[model samples]
Target chain A: MFEIFSYSFMPRAFLVGNLVAVALGMVLGVYPVYLAIIVSVLAAIGVEKLRVDYKDYAELSLAVILSSALGLMTVLVSLSRSNSSIFSYLFGSISLVTPEDLWVIFPISIFIVGGVLVFYYGFFYLSFNEEEAHMAGIPVKLLNNFFMVMVAITISFSMRIVGGLLVASMLILLVATALRIAKSFRDTIIYSIILGIFSVNSGLFISFYVDLASGGTIILSNIIIFILVVLYQFLRDKIRTKRFHYLTSFRR
Target chain B: MNPAIEICNLSFGYQKNLLLQEVNLTINKGDFVAFIGPNGSGKSTLLKLILNTLKPKKGEIKLLGVPNFRFTDWTKVRYISQKVREFNDSFPATVKELIASNMYHQMGFLKLVTPKLSKRIDQSLEMVGLSKCRNEQIGNLSGGQQQRVFIARTLVKEPEIILLDEPLVGIDQKTQHEIQQILIKLNQKLGTTIVMISHNLESIKGQSNKIFLFKDMDVFNYTAKEFTVHLSKKGEWVVNNSYV
Candidate 1:
């Protein structure tokens, strides 16, 4: 684990790490996030054409693509005969990131962030109600495909920093934490991004000094933040209820 | 004076089974029309066809004097499906924020909500009596209040024609009455055209100026007064006298 962070002294490593965290944080939800990524990867790899050609059972598209991805990964792993590379792909190794990775991540980040900002309202509406968004002339299919493409691009690149196994958690957990305290959608997104940056940076710093896996450290940091937020919400609600009872009792 | 919505020999089917056939109807401007029929009568299907969500297998639909396919001015129409309740409640958005989302298309891409748009949101909320709950999370609202919030969301768009599919289904009586009153105001005061689908004919009898009854694959049109007489003759007088 420590060997993986030996390159932590390089500022580019932290920059790439934090960028991955932010991209993951921006797409916050469990099922939708996974669906977007899966659909996007499938579309990118021509699986969607199969669905279109064989319209008889289009619902099986997701299952077909998911299994195909898993099978391909297994085959690739066996053919490469390099367990160390597989380990880095599964759990992430910051030391493994090259300047080439930075170049790839930079342009992808700009595209994802720019697209999200431009269609923020459409995305928000679609999330709430698909039918209503469609009726409002929001081009539901186009927006959905665009979202899936963004998720695919983000996941494909960010997996280098967060690992394929933990990328979804990084996307969801901080937003869940933000939802516990943030009252509005904008606030929730802003808080989640801030929390994501903090967790990634801090986890990187900790893993560098403490010799822990960077991806695992980052996930642990996010979980700790989530637990603290949940506890705080619970205690705050309890105190408010107790105060309400006391005030009413005194009045009576 | 062009009709608000015109359907000519419209027919739609799923697979090989026809759901609606040879449906021809004209809804005049500012007409409060209620589509009353049994389940599977294609009332909702007709609304979807008018909204261009569902394509008719044959015939044509003209919306506000333009062919349905050529009707690019969607801002003039607002549709509230019965599935509005299916919205993700856990989504972190205030009632005000959700309502403001209706302005996105009109505001175009990448534009911030201006003060004028915010004022419109306030007015829409005020109309639906959800002004006090503007900052409240939508999930925290009651089912009826949530429906009202959706209605406010539609109202914020300021559409010329509002179509609702069972807007009062599963709502409390008080909230139902409140929603009806808001619709009545929109129709009577603002002269906005309203097309609603409801199973309970009595509730809409007094509010709607015209009624379209669906039976088999045909539709029968009638004025509100004529529908009352027709229902009485058919020995099916289930008028909700409380509201009447």
Candidate 2:
């Protein structure tokens, strides 16, 4: 791991991933998930409200567009060096993660995270009940748009480290999975953070040992934990039912 | 005096089937008016039209002394729709998170207003009398409790006019009465003008001061006694020609 960090790229990946996650966790936590929920739910009144549109399709288009753009941009600036070195930007070869990548990643992450933290509650409210949110004078449209754009930024930037093939797994594997075992949104968030940290560290080392990819290993770990949680809940329920029967029989 | 809410020649329909027609009404502010109609007779649609969620093919509505559908007037009006039936309970949000969100949206995102924001959250929670359960997740809450959360959400915003579409449908009698009394008090004490639609018209009498019946986008007004004559009075949800 120390040798991995010496390569400059690993540290850059860490900085980008952590910063982007924090920003997304704060902003999307409020906007698209909450406020958009209200709009999307009511939009259910009209068909195709939640239906994925050309814009969503456009994100898929980004991978191809971005790969070419990276290839072109890399050549334009390589002035001194040129070769398969471009593979660093194209695929996250840990060895290729440069200090330059950190410069690109840091400011974007902070801006996204800082913006979300400042307006946390506003985003929180628009999400609660949009009709009421609007009546209460909440700027529903702005916050709704803010969330979509923020999520867009997070997905776009983070796609570099985790790759598009695996980026969605980050949220679904950790946050969405932990939610099954938790009650409140706040609690679910806490649980996801705890679960995320544990899953990532363990997965990282195991992947190193198994000679597998780090990101995919973390996602697999999360899936296993998710199964365990469900099993625990099911067993606990079963035991409670048995206890209830025993008490009823004694009373009879 | 012009009523707080007035509709002239109100009518609404989908592509072809007309929901209501030839409707006219005048309402006073602070009046606890109950809207009674057969299922699909356009009760919810009429209320939605009042809130501008649905547009009438013909007719004009005035609310809170402003044209009902005008862009700005909506801020003064609040609505508690028939249970939204759309919240993904699995969606992460605490009861407090859900309730406080109403006021937060009002302040607008991208601006910071602290303490005052929390105070507003508390006040909204207090309004619906759910201040204690503020920290609970909305998904974990009971249906009746969730309804109270919605009430708190509406209360927090402090709108001048409120429209509820069938608030007392499937909840227990106690929850129904609690909701009814709360709305009645809001109208009488705060002078908030109220228009409510109900599948259970009978339960609303003690709380209602006026009544409107929906028939094919048309509206007819009456006192409680007359409201019953035209309606089933039994308050059953599927109102099919049960008028007594």
Candidate 3:
């Protein structure tokens, strides 16, 4: 495994890896999924209207006209990359996890985690119901924008690892999966964060040993977990309903 | 005295459709005003526009002394909205967690309140007579109980103004009477101003001193005595026996 770092680019790859991981984690950690969905939908619409030759807005300015170009770019990039490569990057692993990755991930994660708690009071107002939040005299817009920026930072950083295709999967899928088993929004968030940490660490190790794509493996693990949760729920509901029917018939 | 809510030349529309037109209204402090009209008379829209959830095309809304959503102190206001389906009660939290949202002031930094939060929570729930269900998960409560829980959430904030949108809608007469008593008690005891948007004039008649008849995209005010005259003249009013 030490030989994995013999190459100069490996360190840079690691640096980028750590940076992306932490960035994604920090964003998913703080941002509200509802607002992020609205923004992402709007961004897609913006991408839809731009002309193909529009030079300045390729990455961010997404109009419908430019969407084709974006889609083509996505496919071309994916096809060129090796099937076994964990990250969707076509260039393959560059420098392995360097000190730079650790540096970026640690401070950024700390900042994101700390910031969420720091602004917890403001967010509590905004989270439950906006009307009550505003009525409570919380600055809803500022807090909303602040949360969005956190998500943007996360998406920008993690795009390298999960690639554009799957970053959303990581953020939304884990929360969604957790939501299935949990009873409340707060519980879902907590469960997703716990699942996120476990999935990330485990997936990374699996990628190292089995040569599986780390990002893909990470999302796959979440999918597997979600499936198991659904199965459990189905069985429990079935048993509960059967018992209820039996009890009613016996009483009759 | 500044009205609890004031809208001037307020007009709002969504894309090519006009919802409210040149709407003007004033709600004074301690006033229990009911906004009544047909469905889609822009009643909810007006409430939302005032809340700044929806912006208007050609008017200004003021809450307290400042224009819409500009109030610095929310301790002066509370909103008991029509029970919408959005509050996903499936999330893991007891009534304590749901009410915890209201105690933002007590634990101002982390938004986490333990003994202090529970004390406030218990008090608010007690106001609605659900103090025993303080630890119960919100989903386990009935619709009326949930509505009361939300009202408790708002009341805990101690807002001077309360904006309720059809608080009595979809509930039994008993629940409606119970909620009405609560609203009346808050207004009379706490001197809180309330603006309720509703279709049932009779449900609000005893509670409301003034009724703003929203019709034909315009809002017209009627004093308590004028209410029967205005409803009779409109010929569109139907009295539901639930309020009777």
- TM-score of the second chain for every model: 0.90, 0.86, 0.87
Q: Which candidate order results from sorting by TM-score in descending order?
A: 1, 2, 3
Candidate 2 residue spans exceeding 4 A from truth: A1-92, A119-149, A156-161, A206-212, A246-248, B9-19, B108-113, B225-244
Relative to the real complex, the DockQ score for model 3 comes to 0.37
Candidate 3 runs further than 4 Å off: A1-95, A121-141, A152-165, A205-211, B1-31, B35-74, B79-99, B102-107, B114-118, B132-142, B209-244
Higher-TM-score candidate of 2 and 3? 2
lDDT of 2 by residue, B28-83 (tens): 87788888766777777777778777788988988866776674755467887775
Question: Between prediction 2 and prediction 3, which has the larger DockQ?
Answer: 2
lDDT of 3 by residue, B149-233 (tens): 8888887777788888887767888987898888888789888898888766666668899888776778878777655632444
Top candidate, metric lDDT: 1
Clashing pairs in 1: none
What ranking emerges by lDDT with the best candidate at the front? 1, 3, 2
Off by over 4 Å in 1: A1-63, A240-252, B8-24, B54-60, B227-244
Q: What is the lDDT, from 0 to 100, of the residue A59 in candidate 1?
A: 44
Against the true structure, candidate 2 reaches a TM-score of 0.72
Q: Which of the CAPRI classes, incorrect, acceptable, medium or high, describes model 1?
A: acceptable
Residue B69 in model 3: lDDT: 59
lDDT agreement with native, every candidate: 0.74, 0.62, 0.65
